[model samples]
Target: MNRHISPDGYRVDGPAGQDDETGADLPAIVGRNLRRLRTRQGHSLDRLAKLSGVSRAMLGQIETGKSAPTISLLWKVATALGVPFASLLTVEKQAGTVVLRRDRSKVLASSEGRFTSRALFPFDSERQVEFYELRVAPFHREDAHAHAPGTRENLIVAKGAIEILVGQHAPVELTEGDAILFEADVPHGYRNSSHGEAVLYLVMTYVETVG
Candidate 1:
């Protein structure tokens, strides 16, 4: 699929002429969720923009499905809305046992496709913890802003080598089979300086369950 750059300078995955696993347009899902949450909280575009540090025009575009959002932008909006990051991407939950097929997993990529995060668990419910599979292109560094207070990330490198930098702390290097856990309320980043791509599994836990 071709990537469409949003006005905010983030790359958005274009529609592939087919529905996602939820049988709904991805952008529309985000837009509907965003609008619902915003209105439910009695927030206007101007108000949300101030709370999220995003532009009012951009917020309007996203809410109207005229533009797709980046992971970082979504995080900011979700934080402002006091909800889980996955809440914006949530779809109808299936009853009984569920299996998330790899082919249909929801993937969000960074600008230039240098970084990608695939949700490993269903986004059907609001939970305190969420799981994801992260990939970093060789020699690429993906930085992330601070998350909500009391949030933490437990990550394990599945392949290749990488460095994790959190706030003012020293960079922690890890190779295959290595793991680390850190507070995520400070700015952090992942650097894959090795020749091969880096793969990691992350489990993000918040202090309390959020919608």
Candidate 2:
């Protein structure tokens, strides 16, 4: 299979040449959502670039479906647009019971692919809480920027050992079955301390729904 690395350094991997479950191109979906939201808020590319700290060229590329955005970049744009992170990924809602199969999960990885996050909930509607599965390569660390105000995260270590660092607070270590809850409005990071990959589950709750 051929793989292409995004400008932000993460690679996109999925069934070759296949669309996502929504039967639409993933990049196109993101692009449409971005363009719609940006125009809706009466913000031009230059204005969005200033607010998001992302270059206008890159923003234009994303809006035109010419480039796939990285997780960090998406977060920056979402924050700037005052919308939920999932808002950029959402498609038409599917009614009734929904089952998210593992093979079909939407996964986002870090630049080096040492860290990954898989969304466990459908991205069809605005939600106050979101669930995700996270994996960190052995001895790898993933740093995340601050989220919107009033955000909170509850995470539990599922396998192996790792350390959680939240802002200036001392690092908190966790083993299998250990969990921690903390405000997520500040910078935070995860460090895997074991020789084997570490697995974790995260529940992120927002203070209010946006977009």
Most lDDT-accurate candidate: 2
lDDT tens digits by residue: candidate 1, 1-211: 5455655455644335565555666678889899998998999999999999999998888888888787789989988877778888887876788787786666777746789888888777667889999999999999999887888999999999999999999999999999999999899999997999999999999885564
Write the residue-wise lDDT of candidate 2 on 9-110 in tens digits: 776454445655556677777899999999999999999999999999999998898888888888889878877788888888889998987887777777
Candidate 1 Cα lDDT to native: 0.84
Q: What lDDT score is found at residue 175 in candidate 2? A: 100
Kindly report which residue stretches of model 1 are placed more than 4 angstroms away from their true locations once superposed. Answer: 1-19
Measured over all alpha carbons after superposition, the RMSD of each candidate to the real structure, in angstroms, is 2.1, 1.8
Give TM-scores for every candidate, taking all chains together and pairing residue i with residue i: 0.90, 0.93
Q: Output the TM-score of candidate 1.
A: 0.90
- Cα-based lDDT at residue 138, candidate 1: 96
Taken over the whole model, the C-alpha lDDT of each candidate is: 0.84, 0.86
